[model samples]
Target: MKKFIIGLFALVGFSAQAAIINISTDQASYNVGDTITANVWIDIVELQGSNLAQPFIGGFVMSLMADATSLSYNDGSIMFGDKLGAGALSALLPVGFGVYSIQSAAFTPSVFTLQAGLTSFELFSLEFTALSSVSDALFGLTASVSEFGSFVGTPVSTASTEFSVEATSVPAPSTGVLALLACFGMMVSRVKARR
Candidate 1:
């Protein structure tokens, strides 16, 4: 009985320390001039032996790196997750070429807290426009979370994904355009037949 209790405590402690940061894009490929959206998610194991261990999140900062030449950061496109709640403060700053810093925090301690359970929640999202064609372009994301009460910061490992951008192709004529051209051609044919 003693050994079983010790083992159970160990398992709960291990699960409590487990957290993951995930980054994902809307699509695996894009065309030049297409908008690309990347989402950041955080999954925390909050159930510690049937009790919720939800932490009060003070703030978080995320760094994103992309190919500047092939992708243009869409200014003012950083959106905070709903879980952060309204009245949250946020900012987007350009760290360097093709690099950006996204920061967000709750107004007060009671504003933002991690939800209980194993559910994965979105932290934020960013948008970029494909400027030029590139093969196997990579977008890298890393982040850190700050606990409000403890003031302890935990760094999340970097997550990255690769995608391709193809050159934009010329669009074919639309059906409306085709119908207009056909009507003009018929009018011209009638005029010539009358002559």
Candidate 2:
């Protein structure tokens, strides 16, 4: 039967090229000496047999670390690891500043498959501006692969993304003196209704 119709068209072309890889960060709501600006993206979604290859080799790279307690991995003056490229995604900058180092090594992963199922997707966005008196700050994302050879069919795994840092509020001073006494009572009731 023609080899079962060419094995059903090669199993529907390897399920239309398998895919799944992600990283995210673009102001999910932060306020505390804010300075969060991140943007990183790399998507392939799915690909295997259909062959949609174009520099597709276990990939991911981007960095910006911060910590002020509870980072986990070790801390030391946090702020070091800024290398983005795996065909480059997108990066803004400014990440949790001052008093942020519990454990951070944001964006640092670039795996290019020498062989194996192949998969790569990373996305990080940005926009953070808060710094009044400080409240909290901690951001992270770590994937590794700049050098470590060994693979013939499937080896490319490195991905991480963490976030925390908030403080950008204003509404005190008696609420701006009650909004200037309700705009001076609506301008004295429109100057007595224009007489």
Candidate 3:
């Protein structure tokens, strides 16, 4: 029972540090028409004495809001491939025009589990298209991660993150192509005039 008691205390100590889920785009800035990728990550502040040989992440659910004017929701944007939940069950719901929720859980009697240690792994990634230069300039998103707690059955903490999209100037299409098209138009106009 000594090991069990130590493990319990270790869990409590880890939980007290406050687990925070941080959300960020792969790039600090993007250009119009670029594919934007947002990554969700969890960070543990300290690891003292969680005498756990293996730790279970259990499951996670997240919700976020986006700017519909500059963004459109696309299916298959969020993905979790046996990272947190092996053979996990997951669902993505469009709560509103600019809102969404994602919930995932492991198989019952076969739930996903991670070895106990410092926690820093990607939960999932969100894909988006920079519809306008405006949205790219201010791509804003919010998310909250939860499910685990500080007990034998429940073993995790929760936190939230707010992030914004940064965008670079929108570039025009190929300049060479545009120049060729202009030359072609001039040649046709000259031939017509000569006729």
Candidate 4:
């Protein structure tokens, strides 16, 4: 029993060191009320030479978290294409106050990529509109491999990262005095044209 437990620990440690889940935003910065898309991906190919070759070998499920105070989840933004065909299982919900969760999973024996160079699996694209009252806000969304994180029923490796989301105040229009200018222009045009 002691040897078995030690082996299990070793296995988990090795797998944990294999792959990682990364996050990225469509834009580096956004203005207040501006909608933004966040992407979660399995960045295995990036770790190609560092001991672990192919981080994600098969289909897997990922659960992500966001800060509801700074952002609100948009409906129907998740897109996984053919590999991910979960009817209602893939969804975004408020699992807690001020904290929201997104679930994404895919299963396909024909769509496995565990070889060679940097391969990226786009798990999902989530859209969120900034909702903070402050002039600016900067935060990050995090992700983790769910218990269902597996490649064809076998446990895979994963790591998580905090991607930044910055929101700034939208610039005001510069044409506030356009009406007055237009009236003056009309008068000047009439005067010039009449003369």
RMSD of each predicted structure: 8.2, 14.8, 10.5, 10.8
Model 2 lDDT per residue over 23-105, tens place: 45555555555455544333343323355653443323434454534222222212322233333333233445422111112
Between candidates 3 and 4, which one is better according to lDDT?
3
* Worst-scoring 10-residue span by lDDT in model 1: 44-53
Ranked candidates (TM-score, high to low):
1, 3, 4, 2
Clashing residue pairs for model 4: 20-159
> All models: lDDT?
0.79, 0.41, 0.59, 0.56
Segments in model 3 whose C-alpha atoms lie over 4 Å from true places: 1-19, 45-55, 108-113, 135-195
Judged by whole-model lDDT over C-alpha atoms, candidate 4 comes out at 0.56
**Which candidate has the highest TM-score of all?**
1
* Higher-ranked by TM-score: 2 or 4: 4
Off by over 4 Å in 2: 1-26, 37-39, 46-118, 123-167, 170-195
TM-score, model 2 to reference: 0.25
- Give a tens-digit lDDT track for model 1, residues 1-195: 999999999999876644367788999999999999988877654312254565556668888899999999888888888666676688889999999988887765444444434366788888999999999988998888876654556786678888999998999999999999999999999999999
- TM-score, per-candidate, Cα-based: 0.71, 0.25, 0.58, 0.54
Colliding residue pairs in candidate 1: none
Candidate 1: Cα lDDT at 166: 97
